[model samples]
Target chain A: MIVAEQKPIDEIKKMVAPYQKLLILGCGTCVKTCFAGGEDEVAVLASALRLSFKKDGKKIEIEEKTIERQCENEFIQEAASCVARNQAVLSLGCGAGVQDIARQFAKVPVLPGLNTTFIGVQERPGLFTEECVGCGNCELALYGGICPITRCSKKLLNGPCGGSQNGICEVDPSVECAWQLIIDRLKTLGQLDNIRAYIPPKDWRSSNSGGPRKLVREDHII
Target chain B: MKTSPSNLQKTLENGKFAVTAECGPPRGANVKVVRQKAELLKGVVDAVNVTDNQTAIVRMSSIAASAHLVQMGLEPVMQMVVRDRNRIALQSDILGAWSLGIKNILCLSGDHQTFGSQPDAMNVFDIDSMNLLRMVKNMRDNGKDMSGFELNEAPQMFIGAAANPFADPFEYRVIRLAKKIEAGADFIQTQCIYNMKRFKEWIRLSREEGLTEKVYILAGVTPLKSAGMAKFMNNRVAGMDVPEDVIKRMEGVPKEKAVAEGLKICLETIAELREIKGISGVHIMAIEWEEKVAEIVKAAGLQK
Candidate 1:
């Protein structure tokens, strides 16, 4: 899931302050699951913003609305009426969603209320750890399903650097060393030899290094 | 046997137990600091390793510092970390460093940025240490860059890599060393050794795998300044294992006597390291304490 956290209410307030009529847009999919931008969150944020603005003796109107997903045009249309009525949209969506809304409603200003962190899964409630970097090329099979490119602090492919101590990364004691996990998992799968093979220098051209990537699916286009 | 223009390599090749010391560049652009450190290390060690922003803290460029060492009639093993530079900058610096008469290069995946003064800095680990080693090897041996572009003159660097016998997944450490050797490392400098038992085990495994014959292995030794430093490293420093007995030994001494005890412990470790079959040399990392290096070397009877 796309994990993100809400920007501070102060920053959000400053962003929406110029507009008298504002819409607190919520994304119901990834951000919703992470509780950053959801129906309940949007309502709470709306109430908070109202109280904050009222305290300052400023008269501002806010409307809260959430759709199934902000990425797709169909779901985005659900909030079209609310978006048109407001001067600007305080998008409680990921960066991509904010851009998507901005692209659709070219005139309305779409401000990002949440900071899109990473493409990750919730390790536990309120705990989200990054698992993938979308490097475009995946070598999970060789690493026992562990992604060193994403998890390892150094993005080391050959093996763990000297920093891996007692299954913990030297970069952060809390973060488990990715190479340790790979070695253990490979040992469990009886594929320990996989690690012995030298992984050559990664081709960064496939990753974001090449530039913003695009995938075209002719079969799904029709 | 002279594969590169590295005096360190020649010394090791001539069946001599080489001695190398680390010299970190100053935090600011101060040539005097580097020269002062160089003066202390001059003639005491075979080659001085100029660290590239070690601990991820900003420092004077290693290349510039290494060039300074070259001017001072000292051989330098310019450490290159993959954390800061991409393939382009790394290759460019290799050529530039070699041009500046720097012969030896230590390839490393540098300390993470979070541990440094600039925690907010973005890191560029475009290549790992292994890849950096391979890249340098290719540039030196094949006379080709990473993109297969032929170079005007190959940077004939005596490639070096680091090893940590104390790091976890203990069994695979030897395998990693083998991989480093295969990747084109002519020599290996290990992380600081306080755990003799584990270091011996790692050496035994390396010997069994015959990795010792493939690459020169330099045992790393750092004189613990005090019991507090020992405890701090044991708990905080990554991949550093200071045994409880060693810490107790340091604590047993009075605060004023701790420095002498630390030197004694270092000398004892050097003696033990000398007896090890696969151990080729000792790389002393005095940290900010470069003055003690010559004294330690002379006291260990390594001063030629």
Candidate 2:
């Protein structure tokens, strides 16, 4: 799931100030679940902007269309036909939705209505926390099921840093030590001795921190 | 023609047995959905109230829907919720609705963000529902805004609010209603009522406590169509209490008979509400069940 947060109303208002015919698109997927760009928020924001535009003696046609999902091309098309007349689309979806809409519309400017935060799950109803990062490689088997790239304070692969104390990382004591989890999982499987094996240093050259990343599968692409 | 304030006052004074119905706007831009509901209930009910985003789902604007209702020759009561809007937007919408000659209004704070498909939403209860009531009254009476600042023309509206019983303590609910009444609420449309015994008792108590004379009260009713609907009302809706006997009746009957039973129960409740001395009206909430409303009213022995 893509975690997202609502941009403050003022910030979004400024973002779409130049557009007269505004089309507020609501996504029913991630942004809706996160309460950022859902059906309700889109209506509220539209009403607010409508009144604001009215007070300025400006007649702006701010329409609302809530698609079931904004990430997919098919669902985004549900909003496309009606949006051509509008000057800009104020997307109440995730960052992916804004980009996807922009890709589809091409001519019309698509502004984000929510700040994409993370990819996470519903820990419980009404609450969501950071979960997966979707890093290019998966090393979960070597360190239990818990992802070190997303959860660890230090993305240690070879060994646990010497600074760990009480199963907490030294960088932030509140964060659990990823190495400790790996150790526990290993002990459970009677493979604690694997820690003695020398592992190569992680190459950061291919990671997102260097620059943009792309994936291409020969089987899927012609 | 614009009716004089005194004429409105006199009409409202003798407005006993007033019947109201609700129409929710469509989620899409097409006005047909709302217009269809308004036209179906028009002339049959005294006033038609348009709801703003019930259940926090996206919909067309209630004000625009009210405009359509007004065009259809129905007295439109525009519902405004402050939960989404700041004071500026709320005040402007009220004035705009009034300028459009749509006078009656229902001021609601609306559903919280947590209840909707959306969570983590920012609730600007900057001004609660009561304060909006005071603001509207102050704007018209004192010719000033909420901050005592002057405006060129203040909108005069027939103010109304909602009351929920059977959720919290009944006395507290009554007290809350009394507070809204004290804050210049001219009328009240209550939450859904399925049991007349509890409703009549509440009305009797309110009359005893001097609530009946101060403001008009309209009991809200919505028919429970199926056993699933009854279950949803009982569990999902916080204040609405659909009685087990009614559910049992619906369950035991055939599918066709069950709808008739539901309509019959609603008519009985409405007839009972009409007989209550202090009750002024009934607000029928036949949401998607608009077609069954006329039948229900006729069965209730009310003039349409």
Candidate 2 error regions (>4 Å):
A1-222, B1-11
lDDT of 1 at B227: 100
Per-model TM-score versus the true fold: 0.98, 0.57
Leading candidate by TM-score: 1
Predicted structure 1: lDDT: 0.94
- Looking at model 2, the pairs that clash are none
In the order shown, the candidates' DockQ scores are: 0.82, 0.01
Query: Residue B200 in model 1: shift from native, Å?
Result: 0.3
Docking class of 2: incorrect
Top-DockQ structure, candidate number: 1
Candidate 1 lDDT, B28-116, residue by residue in tens: 99899999999999999999999999999999999999999999999999999999999899999999998999999999999999999
Instruction: Tell me each candidate's RMSD, in Å, in order.
Output: 1.5, 22.7
TM-score between model 2 and native: 0.57
Q: What is the lDDT of residue B169 in candidate 2?
A: 40
Candidate 2 residue lDDT tens string, A162-195: 2344466544546666666666677688775564
lDDT by residue (tens digit), candidate 1, A65-162: 99988899999999999999999999989999999999999999999999999999999877999999999899999999999999999999999999
